[model samples]
Target: MPKLLLLEAMGNTGEYILDAARHLNAEIIVVTHEDVHEDWYSPTLKAKIAEYGKLVFADFSDSEGALRQLKELARAEGVDGVVAGWEFLTPLVARLAADLGLPGNDPTRSLSCRNKRIMARAFTEHGIPAPRTVAARDLGEAYTLVRSAGLTYPVVVKPSEQSGSWGVSVVSDDEELADAFVVAQSHIFQMPHGIPLDPHVIIQEYVGGTEFSIETVAVRGAVTPLFPYDKFTTGGAKRAEYGHTVPAELDAAQVAVLQEAAVAAARAVGITNGVAHTELKLLPDGTTRIIELGARLPGDHVVALMRQARGIDEARIYVQIALGQEPVLTPTADTAAGIRFLTPPRGGTLRSVTGLGDCDAVALSKMTVPPGGRVRAPGDNDSRVGYVILHADTAAEVNAAAAQVLANVSIEVV
Candidate 1:
């Protein structure tokens, strides 16, 4: 069996990738910090990885050291493919794949896929449709650039290197820009491995309209577009995603537009192989602007939803592409799936959740953060206490069921 080396199997996508590797009969080796595996990983994740294949520990913060160690491990373990289960390590994934001569993206420009400033440059260079953005190292520079660029109010301020809407805010004016900049630059190191991150902040013209995400599977420069999904973000300064509905309710023309934009965005960032999760916004004028794209699988259990709705396993496709094999993109069903995150009304100790059994269409209900655990305010992905996954024959039904589940579910936070 071909052995695949995966980086950081601790996120939601990790389990799905493990399941996919098993389905493909591929041996899997997960590389992560030993402490992370011991501390942050759940019992289920640990057990699953142990049962599936080997687990290798590495220091992700030290990029060069980890790369060298991974090279040695790959050679010794006879690893045939390398994939990244985390978004922040996309560059590392490309570099490792290139070192092994495996199927992957362009290592030379892989940083563009991680850093927003670099990604904006790549998009501009490739003439990709994206928002006009400016990077600033400090507040003074941001103010100067904002005025000179003639950027209007309600612009987006975000960290150059962050995910899940962390440290992202929409500023309505100059007064709000400074606070947003601080939040954007507050993060200095990433979790699990303590990897140092870029301190710079990016200010972009907010692309106003509905937001959507598309997943693409690429093999040897061939890109296959998966079903697009609707992204529901909070309408406020902090654009935290509330949920997602699969097979986004869009007309054929709109779907085509989204697919084309997704492909262009993927190619702009040099995604030759593997999967890309791309986010876009449809403007009022019927045009679309690329918000961002990651050289990894979609989060929020999107892979599971896709499988439940259409019988298509995106995780399987990702592994197949990494293994230099053809991916299965054909959908067997036309159903719809939705997931709604249960956020606490206020930041406090969680008491209990009720009314979980009131929904008939609810397929699975999971409370990630248990009672007595402290919960943060609903601003980013970290604040979600639990989630409800629903499945139905039609998009309306799926949406209705998700809404009902959210309405009935009561989270008591002290």
Candidate 2:
């Protein structure tokens, strides 16, 4: 059995990775903090990891210490590959693979994949189309840089190193920049592993356009682009994602344009061999600018939707790429699928959810939080209490079903 060491098994990707590993007949070992395993990990994840293989505990906050321990463990257990299920640890994945002499990204520029400032520099160096950005340690610096860089109003402010649209806000004037800066810099440490984070906030030119995401699988320095998907985000100051639809409703020519940009962005980030989840915006003038890209599988149950809609398991493909095997990229199905998150109206105690059974096309509905669970305002991915997954014969049908589901469903918070 081929042994793969996975860092951080607490996110939505963990279940899909474990299922894919089982299908591939590969042994999976999860490395996570002991305290996190005891406190924050859900029973479903714990049981899934336990059934597949062993769970190794470590301190993710101290990268150097964790690297030393992981090296020893890898040597002792004869680990074949290193993969990370979490986006926050993409740099760690690169470092581990480099230390093990395995197929992976370049650790020298790996931080660029996770930090927006470094990412902007890499994009500029490679001439990849991306939003112009500036990093600031405080509000005063941000104001000065915005003026000097000629950045106009309606700029985007977000953490230099965060994902899922957390702390991301679009400000229309100088008066709102300070509050946005504070929100972006509030998160100093990542949860579960307590990994220290960069406190700098990134101020980016607001790229106005339709949003989409593309996943790429690379093996032996060759990258293969997967099907593009339409991304939907909430409008207004906070740009939290609302849902996604697979096999994006795009013509052949438009798909080609997006794919080319995605491939270039992946190469610009020094992604030699691995999976990359890239988000891009298609401007009204037909120009596409990369929002961000991570060297990991996408979150929000995207793998499942992709599999159901296209007969391709991205998680399995990611594992194969990591193990130096050719990934199965050919799609056998031509249908469509989608997922719409159920967000609360406001921050309060969850009372109940209703109208979930009204849609016949609804394949599954999962509520992550129970009744009386305190819910935060709809700001980011964390505010989503549950999601509805749907499938249909056509993209239009799938989108209609998702829309109906969202309309009918109601989340009651007291």
Candidate 3:
């Protein structure tokens, strides 16, 4: 059995990774801050860890110190592989794996995968198709840089290092840009571990197109790109993802465009091994731009959706890649799956949510928020209150059922 070192199991991806470990008969040793493990980890994750894994506590805020501690622990544990359960820790994972003489991404360029400013520079240097982005330390600098970049209004202002679209906004003018800048600057650190973040903000020329995601796997520097999926995000200033359809409805040529962009991005970011969850935009001009990429598994229960749709267990594949084993990518089924988030009309105190009808295609419907919980407006992924997952024989059928299922649902918030 291969022993794996997982750096912080915090999201749905972590849960799925732990569950996959069980099926593979692998031993998992998770490293996280003690406080975060207590506060953020779900009971199910804790139980899974208790069953076949061990937990180690370290202060990730001190990156060097944490790396030292983890290195010693890795040696003692006789770990065979390392995986970043969170995107922010990709750099550290690279460093750890490199120090252990294990297969992993290039440690020197790992920061390019996490910091947008660095990632933009990498893309520019590599000639990767990406949005024209410039970084700034303040509003004045932002204005200067945006003009210098030859970017126009309706630009995107966001933190240099944040996930889930947390401080991202589309601004149409200078005043809106100023407002968005402060919001982006406010995200100065990552929580739970108190990890410091880049103080600069990125002012990027907005790419107008349909967004899609592709999951790519690499082993011993060889890449295998998966099918591109529909990343259904709401368009506006917020760009919150409301739904996702597996096997995005697109022709072979279109899929090739997305997958090529994704693979190029993964390679540019030094993702020589393990998995990359890449997001891209297909412009109206029959071209695509690399939006961003995560050197880890796809988030938002996508692991579940992929399995239901293609019978491709990405979670399992991720584990195999980390262990330097050939990933099992052959499809076991030909189907489709989708997930739609339930959101209130606006931000308010939650009162009630009803009218979720049990349609045949509906596989699971769940409310994550309870009554009286304060809810934010649907601005980002965090604003979601609940979600429903559906499945069918094809993407069209799944999407059709999704529309019908969501149309009948009602959410009431005071």
All candidates' TM-scores?
0.98, 0.98, 0.98
Put down candidate 3 lDDT per residue, 1-414, tens digits, no spaces. 899899999998998888888788899999999999999998998998998888999999999999999999999989998988898999999999999998899898899989999999999999999999999999999999988879999999889999898989999999999999999999687997889999999988899888999999888878889999999887788877889999899999999988888888888989888888888999998899998888888888989999999999988888888787888889889899999999888999889888887799999988888999999988888888999999999999999999998889889989
| Residue 173 error, candidate 1, Å | 1.3
lDDT per residue (tens digit) for residues 1-414 in model 1: 989999988899998889889988999999888899999888999999989879988999999999999999999999989988888888999999999899999999899989999999999999999999999999999999888988998899999999888999998988899999999999889986899998889999988888999998888998878877989999789889989989898888888888999998899899999889999988777789999999999999989989989999989988998898887788999899999999998899999999887677888888989899999998888899999998888888989888777778889999
Q: Which stretches of candidate 3 lie over 4 Å from their true place?
A: none
Q: Which residue pairs show backbone clashes in model 2?
A: none
lDDT of 1 at 90: 88
lDDT for each candidate structure:
0.90, 0.89, 0.90
Q: Report the C-alpha lDDT of model 2 over 1-414, residue by residue, as the tens digit.
A: 888889987788988888888888889999988898888778988888877779989898999999999989998888888889898889988999999998899999899889988999899899999998999998999999999999999999999888889999999998899999999999889886788988999999999989999998777777778878989999999999989999799888778888999999988888998999999998888889999999999999999999999999999988887777788789999999999999999999999999887676788889988999999999898899999998888878989899877888889998
**Model 1 compared with the native: what TM-score?**
0.98
Alpha-carbon lDDT of model 1: 0.90
